[model samples]
Target: MTMNKIYSWQHKLWNKLTHHADSGANALLLKGRAGIGKLDFARHFAKFRLCETPSSTSEACGTCLSCGWFEKGGHPDFYHVSPETSANFSGEAAVAVDRDESAGRIKSKKKTSQQISIVQIRALSDFVYMTGHQRGRRIILICPAEAMNAAAANALLKKLEEPPAHVLFILVAHRPQQLPATIRSRCQLINMPMPDVVQATRWLKQQGVNEPEACLAAASFAPLLALTFNDQRYAAQHDAFIEQISASRKINPIELAEKMQQSDLPIVVSWMQKWCYDLLCFCLTGKVRYHLSRMTTIRVLASSIENKALAAFLRTLLVSQQLARHPLNPRLFLEEIFIKYATLLDSNGVKRSS
Candidate 1:
């Protein structure tokens, strides 16, 4: 769909960006947490910049020829770079490489790469150096810029260093720290804003999402991700996972691991992380963050565990999150974490089943 307007939370940032649209910066880094509409904002800005007749508010004129080309995903001056397995600007998918089996399975029969290769970066040489449609300014949008491998990142760094005239590079990264320091320094870094709970819930309601607050918390306050909580498959899986984990005393780590082996490991680990975070938060501050509906269970569990032990477990989850992406055995990986969690609870006087 065409991005005609920015999100409500983004109006101020939009004004700030448009006010300096002609500042002559060739590259921009739109970095922030995932699912907050940074990509949509970038698309809107690019459309505005390419519009032959922009509005007084610096918005795209939908009727312009440039706007038409952009909406059709065939703009001569617009280029998008993403991992081969990702959806392109036109919503088309491609194949590349498989980094980790346990990181998450793509579900495709053909293995695909999750990285933006050097070839894709080098391919931009033609688009960047060539003449644009009607000789207007060109825009290159690279989303999740951290997905670029070392070679690809270094290649893009060169272009950012000696950027061609009349071209803008917009790099959108959920984890900007993962991007090289040299690459980050070469562009205009824009820290995208996060919508507050009220605004995010309102937006989700406008999108017809029920239980917006709980969903919002489940997604760590990322509205777009919270939207996925409405999906039947994902919701069922997440609910089941949480329910089983809540029964720490009776949870069979091996069985749970087998049941969720097909799921994304990093995501499963994150689910555990959020659950533990809430448990710890309740123990210390008497409040819950993610599992808003499970206050009673969290309260009971929090009282059973020591703050120091829970905090240490939380730190281990951070390391698990990293290795989850490249684990050799997904089942064993899951079993190990679940077992540790059950043991922690058991040690805290939570009786374990035989």
Candidate 2:
């Protein structure tokens, strides 16, 4: 299988990183917001560096022996480490990791952790010290570096401290601030920039997404995430969701919760947060952000909403977002959220606490 190509916007950054591959930096941290393709860029760069004979553009020759192993995710010199919940971890890689676990390693019967554990990091550290299966550069890619717990981060820190020769560490992180100062200071930071609206929309359209502008807006103008929303049919549902919430007085919490049960709770909560944000924007500046096409609806809703109540609801959604990954009855969670939203339009102007 061929690796997914990096987005067009990442070309310059890719070239710069590839040029620095020979600069002898052992650790590189790519930090940015979601959907900017940092991991994809890192993957392509790693392939290029590992390729016995790469193309003129410093891209991997897909037919090379090294490229074939990388594509199959069986490259002996490449380690792709991520949390189980991360989208970046392929099913094949998951199986391979399980198969390669040592007999002395502690095993857990419970679900694979969503976090990158100390065990995984320790194993990776050991792997890097062992003889390579091939005589070329070795690379370890750890995505969402924030997922590492205190122990795991400390374990990784050791590797960063005593740097290995001919080995490169690519750490892709969505939230760099979550990483410890010690861990962060050891690696070179690369800030991935968000693509402009025109570029984002054009790329989104090329992927055959409908209402690309609206989808991009809903995703905070992140093209890759916009494509995901479109693929999952969330973009189409967003308009109807906004319409439902705009009519806050008639909102049915149970019905709305049931309708959105299929969607991820965090995503649903995020959409609610964005809607409330737009309401506040309209209330303050008579303008909108995410829901640009719903200016009239937003303005009317903002007018009817009690400012205090809306503010409280917005704070409630923030808390909800934090708990989205935890165990919860999705329907009950959504119902409670929608119920609070309903009260925002109440004539009594009552503020509720979570």
Best by lDDT: 1
Task: Flag clash pairs in model 1.
Answer: 96-113, 97-112, 97-113
- Model 2 regions more than 4 Å off: 1-4, 85-113, 236-263, 306-323, 326-354
RMSD of 2: 6.8
lDDT of 2 by residue, 1-354 (tens): 124577888878888877666887789999887666666677788878888888787778888888888887778788888766343333364432222111101122345554788888888866688777667478888876776888989999999999887788988876688789998899898998778999988888887888898778867777776665664544556667777887756788899988876555556677799899999888888877888788888877787776777788899887787555333576788888988788667653343221
Write down the TM-score of every candidate: 0.86, 0.78
Error of 2 at 251 (Å): 5.2
Task: Give per-candidate clash totals.
Answer: 3, 0
Candidate 2 has a TM-score of 0.78
Name the best candidate (by TM-score).
1
lDDT of 1 by residue, 22-71 (tens): 99899999988766778888888988999999889778889989999888
What lDDT is reached at residue 213 by model 2? 89
Worst 10 residues of 1 by lDDT: 94-103
Q: Which clashing pairs does model 2 show? A: none
